[model samples]
Target chain A: MGRVSLAGVSKTYGDPGQTVTALTNVSFELADGEFCAILGHSGCGKTTLLNMVAGFETPSAGIIRVEDQPVSGPGWERTMVFQDYALFPWATVRQNVAFGLEMKKLPADARAAIVDHHLDLVELTGFADRYPDQLSGGMRQRVAIARALAVSPRVLLMDEPFGALDDQTRRYMQEELVRIWRREPKTVMLVTHSIDEAILLADKIVVLSSRPGRIKQVLSVDLERPRDEDSPDYLALKRYLRGLIHAETAA
Target chain B: MSGAAAGTAVPVILPARRANWYRRLKPLVLLAGLVVLWQLVCLLWLPRLDRQIAILLPSPVQLASTAGKLIATGELPHHLADSLRREAVAFALALWAVPLGIAMGWWRGIHQQFYPVVEILRPIPPLAWIPLSILWFGLGDVQNEFIIFLGMVFPILLNTLEGVRQVDRNLIRAARSLGAGEAVLLRRVVLKAALPQIVTGLRVGLGFGWMALVAAELVGANSGLGFLINDARSLLRTDIVVVGMLAIGVAGLTIDFALRGLARWLLPWSQQQGGR
Candidate 1:
């Protein structure tokens, strides 16, 4: 189980005398196996918060704990899917998926097995031998997802994983992500700016105010799976969250 | 639908055969034109203008005949073999320099310690060390090899350092997030990312190395293309000198072509992506 808790997490950059705060007095808790989405405007420190949770950055003023242990540096338990789909262009899709497993010093056969499973999970079994440059934008992102999942991380942190994709591909990937998340239940923290995306996929949505980011609200999503956009309940929640985000960004 | 149907569904395709033929023959045509121009200037035009110029610069026919005589006596082949041997040794030494370059690029301390020394030494041309090389190795292949080594090492070293420094920060961060430690990060990500640039460095270094080879051999070598040219100059056999110059140019071109092929084979992804 991967339960992450951030208490009064504040990140300030530059010297203390002349500093710029990115996140201020931010607190959130993601329960085990819960899919949480941090929704905020650009420069609202959503990525900084996610990076802190991923242990890529340290919080200036608060404690971030994952499964009761203080976060240190990047660990295998918290794999990230970056927005740019950072698949190694030199490695084939199969090899890219196997990267984390190899880092963990798994045997060749086991590594191959896990890589094949993840590739198949992403429906990219046929393109196993192709490099990232040979794949389309969506295909590369799927490869990134497969690579991240191949290690069986305790928590998956995705930083706007589908932001670079077109609308059609983005919608398709959102569905694919949910389907995959259900099949392999792990605590997931997705950072995104899209209100509909947050409402559609997240079990809980945390909205933050712009600049020197502070938590504005945390709304628990109680809608059923495969929530319809046209449904009154889904639209209502989307409108409410959009209003909240719009207000924060506008202010 | 009717209006669209009236327009041609498929664009007319132009036959690429003529264009392909022209592209294929372009270099040879240009080279032949250059030779014709040279023959016209030296054999026909220059002698009319100044008889002494014709005596100094051999025409294409004279050069060809001289090359034929050398080939028949196997002298050209022997000299070429010696020169190639020296080149191979220098190139091998240059290959050894790559690891040090990689270390310097990867570690900040190493870069700090060695980079200033490299910067100070790099601007001084390799040929400037010819006298020192002669004093040390004393009129042998080792002296020529030293000059070539000096010429080749910097391009490989600097290019490798730049390649490592230019590796995408996001790629490293992504690898770290996937549990890669320092060694794994260097081996799997940094090395692979830097490879295309390294290959480019090797190619550039080899070109400089070949240029230095002639300079090195000119000073004190007994059996190389440079020596061939120097000997012909002393003997007043301008045709043989021209032949030696041609041989060096052709050999350099051939080796550069081979290295390019190697780069293409080693980095298929870079080729596909149209990376240099």
Candidate 2:
């Protein structure tokens, strides 16, 4: 069975006059240990769908299930990395990463160990005591990644996690994400607009149409993990993904 | 190595320690200069103290003598205690007002329902309510406390409401995603996000409260800095009035400095906003 599955989901926001249909009958399943990407335009209910699995929002229509159980409330088994990093500015990197474990009621030693372990994984061990303000954007995002991974969630939902970083930093983050995924494979659902990014990370690229987003197409990457962006195959795949987006817009 | 790099300079001293000392002393030196000019003006033009001439605004020498005698007589401590009590009571009462304001502010329906009434209550000045407070609680500590509470609560409530409203909607969504229920959301996310602004509000409110406390005390209270100056007015003790005035300024300045330090310690994240 899939680790994270969405079935016939729809979400409408607000009252009749100002109502916004954010998602319409969207369905997908993330296979265990696969890195899946949800690619769509900015307004395309992509984040909303992710919010459902994160248990931030319940589907207005259908249902979403995590590990074959109906997603009732936000579970510790699934963690989300927001686009803006959302690192508590008042907290040190270690404290921010320790938040989930602390919520889980882990003993201090165990929680500290897990926080240290993830910080090491993200190559931020030296920055544990440093506050988010003291760190650069890239470093902050790395700390955020560590914070999410520290919880050891079964399914990781990344919503434009590297969207705020510069190009070089974004590339570095993507590579690091792939490396982390290899170290400990969990069902990963990443939402992004960059076709190159989706191609680089996703085992399957799930494309959505514009507004009131629905699954327009799902394309298998066919390329291997830790894929090279400079390679001809990766570029070709990116062009194909871009073409799909253009086609959707044109229609 | 000894030669000056610049064309005009014979020797490069790296601007002497004397220059650094001068730079540090500049503001105090400027203040001293202003004092001398005022003294000179007073010496040349003003004849005597009739309270009519603006130039007769008590000389530093006169103020020191007045201040010294007031302290020697133990009136300073008595007045200071009275002022401190009013401030302490008002501050405690203001704390109670914040959660009440938050309840009204956080919930949309509550805000709508209470906003009109709150707005109506807010416009009436704390000073205007002095007569009623005196009538209701009589001329004592209770009346003084009531007036201070009235003075501070409006600004505190307005500030708290603004802080709650200003909290990022995204943070709320993020908290909900983390399994933060209503209680957790209020305690963890909402309160944390709103704190810096609330502190600012509290600071402003406390300042107004102090001013109102003095005003309230001046009317009928037997003790306090305000009462000290006021009673001195009838006795024609200008020295005590001057001492009382200076004491209020110094005390207010000290409390404001302490509050700024508290804001820094409490909201470390606030400084990192990076102009955004």
Candidate 3:
């Protein structure tokens, strides 16, 4: 189950007189435990699409469903990792991870165990007591990922989760993310402007047109794990995707 | 080699220790210098100007003796306790502003409804409320507290409102996505995020409340530092008035120092927030 499906989704902002369409008739489906990346230019409403799926925003038209149930609002079943790593500043890493479990009214012992496990999963077990301010950006994002995973959400939404990091940290975190996903698969939808990131992580990459984002192409990534960017096939795919985005941007 | 290492260590450590000691004593040294200058003026300049003016402005020594007598007679302590009690009660009562402010900040309708009323009332100084407070409470601690409350509530309320308004929207969304209900989000995320600003509001509010309390006591009460100052002025005991003034300054400084300590303890993560 746990298939996320969007049918003819459209989102418009502002009043009827001067409406700005953020998304227009976008339709896609994420299969159970599938890793899907929505690649688009900045301000293409990729984040808006992710928010709609995560139930932070509602589409003006069309429906989004997961497991045959219509998505309502933010729920425990879906958790998100933000680019800003929105860990509660007042909370320690452990407490941030336990927040979802606490909301579920889980027993203290169970919550603690889950928190420990997730912290270990993110390789931040040594920093469980530290506040978010004490952490590097990468470490903070790891805590956020741990927090999202501690809930064992059916759907994991990441909004350009590594976009803010330096290049080295970004590459390291991308690998870390893949390793974690391989260990514990979830229906992951990562929105990013980085074509390399999309190719490296996603099973399927859905490219979108510029503002008033529409699904332009949905290409399956048939490459093996640890995708080699220098390989002929990988380079060819990158060139093709870049050409597609360049055409949209130039237009 | 060991002796050379020790010699090098002494040179490195001695300067740092000396610098820290100097830093610690710098303010006190300046304060002492000012006091000496005041005493010198009292001895040489004020008396030469006029004996009557010298009597009106008591020297530090004269003020100290007056203060000693008041303390020995328990008069100073009694007045201090009375003023502190009024301030404490008023501050406690004013704490209701926190929740009310959060409500106003969080909900648009509530903010729109209450903000205008607050703006209209806030501009009227707490001392301005004294005549009405005395009429309502009949010249007592309640009257003094009412005035202090008026002085305190607005700073706290407005600061809390701003704090809540400025909370990171992403934090609220993160909490919601984690299954935090509205109440849970407000209590856990919103309140914690706003605490630094709330502490700042408390500090400013207490200062205003203390000043208002003194003013109210001067007008309508029989005991307190303000009353003592007024009484001394009426009796021409300028030494007692100066001592009372000193007590007010010292007490306000102590309250602010304690609040700074509290803020440091409460927000170890937010070391840079809220200027002294």
Candidate 4:
């Protein structure tokens, strides 16, 4: 139910006479229950592409469809985890996780259960009473993820969700996310610049070139679960992806 | 390891506690010194130099006696209650600015329509409206309230506008993606995010409104601290005049203190408001 398809998407900003193109005639498909990473350098419009799917922005020319329905405005069916972990500062962790359920007008009893379940899922069960400011960066992002997943959306969009965390925390969170995905599968599109991250988590990797981004390569990861970074195949794929990105940057 | 760390921490905390104690005492000590100097000048120094000038500046002991008589007679409390009531009604009336400001901040067309009008009116002092207010409401509670409202509404409205405009864009997007509609988003997200700033606006507006209320009462009312001050001045009761002025100062400080406490309670997540 969560398959997403993009057909010839392009985005342009500013007036017609003086315009800046961010994405150019890009197209790709994400199969249901698959984890795909859109890997690119900064300012590469990877985030813009993700935003269009999340319905925060519209493509100037092209179509994006989720579950065979044309993408429209933001809805509960498609949720996102932001890099900044935009949890409401005033709301407690439990309340933040329960936000979507509340929006859906779920009964209090049902909402509480779902909130507890998701907070437990994100391993923030003991921190439900804390405000966003009281938590560390990694804990706040966990709250964001828990908040997004509590709604049980069909498609999950993460825009560099762990980019703000330290290297150790980021690696730890990657494994935690993998563990969660294995237990409860959902369509996920992760946009990031980290190659190891993409290789470790994604079922498919779509690499885009720099500014005015267009898909340069779409490689499927045939590796087994919990792929080792030092493994020969993992190293080889990382090397190959690095070469592709370096060529684009050099050019 | 823990024992040594605690031992080192003890010395640091001792100095910090002493510094905090000094900080708290410094202001009160200075205020006490100033009061003693005022008593000295009025009772011991000024009377020798000029008896008339000494009579004009009442000594602390003289002011205390005047204040005690006013309190026993209930005159001071009556005036205070009237002034506070006028301020309360006008401040409550001015709260309509919050929603209007949200509209202006959220919608470009509304902002374009209302901004110029606000800018034109905002710079005009509340005291400037006293004459017109008296003409319209004819020297009663309504006249005083109108002046206070004029003083309050602009600050509340402008701060609310700034607050709404400065709401983090990502919070709105997150709420939307979580299935919150426009109205829901405004009520649940935007309003909560802007609350600390709104409270700040309320504080500033209350101060302005209190000052405006006193000014309005001076010109066109019969029963307020301002009226009492003016009445005392007419009768050459300098002690009562000083009492009325001190009442106004204490009342203003109390109002601001209460609003700050309310803001802290309402917004526990906001450390910036507490810092102010």
- Which candidate leads in lDDT? 4
Cα error, candidate 3, residue B105 (Å): 1.4
**lDDT tens readout by residue for model 1, A57-117:** 9999999999999999898889999999888988999989999998999999999999988
- Where's the lowest-lDDT run of ten residues in candidate 3 chain B? B267-276
Interface RMSD of each: 0.9, 2.2, 0.8, 0.6
Give the CAPRI rating of model 4: medium
Ranking by TM-score: 3, 4, 1, 2
Off by over 4 Å in 1: B1-23, B40-43, B47-50, B272-276
TM-score of each: 0.92, 0.91, 0.95, 0.94
The TM-scores of chain A alone, one per candidate, are 0.98, 0.95, 0.99, 0.99
* Model 4 chain B weakest lDDT span, ten residues long: B267-276
- Two-way lDDT contest, 2 vs 4, winner: 4
Q: Arrange candidates by DockQ, highest first: which order?
A: 3, 4, 1, 2
In candidate 3, how many Å is residue B121 off?
A: 1.1
- Candidate 1: clashing pairs of residues: none
Fnat measured on candidate 4: 0.86
Q: Write the per-residue lDDT of candidate 2 for residues A1-251, one digit (tens) a residue.
A: 33878899999999978989999999888788888999999999999988888887888999898889898767667778888887766678988888777767789999988988899899998988998888998898888778777778888889999999999999988999999888978889999998989988889889999787989998889886668778889989888888889998888
Clash pairs, candidate 4, are none
On lDDT, who's better, 1 or 3?
3
Q: Residue B196 of model 4: what lDDT?
A: 89
lDDT measured at residue A248 in model 2 versus the true structure, 0 to 100 = 81
Q: Residue by residue across B1-276, what tens digits does model 1's lDDT show? A: 785664564243233656778889987997899989998898778889898778899999888898999999999999999988998999999997678888998899999999999999999999999998899999988999999999999999998889999998778888998889998899889989988888988989999999999988887899999999999899988989989999999999898888888888888888732234
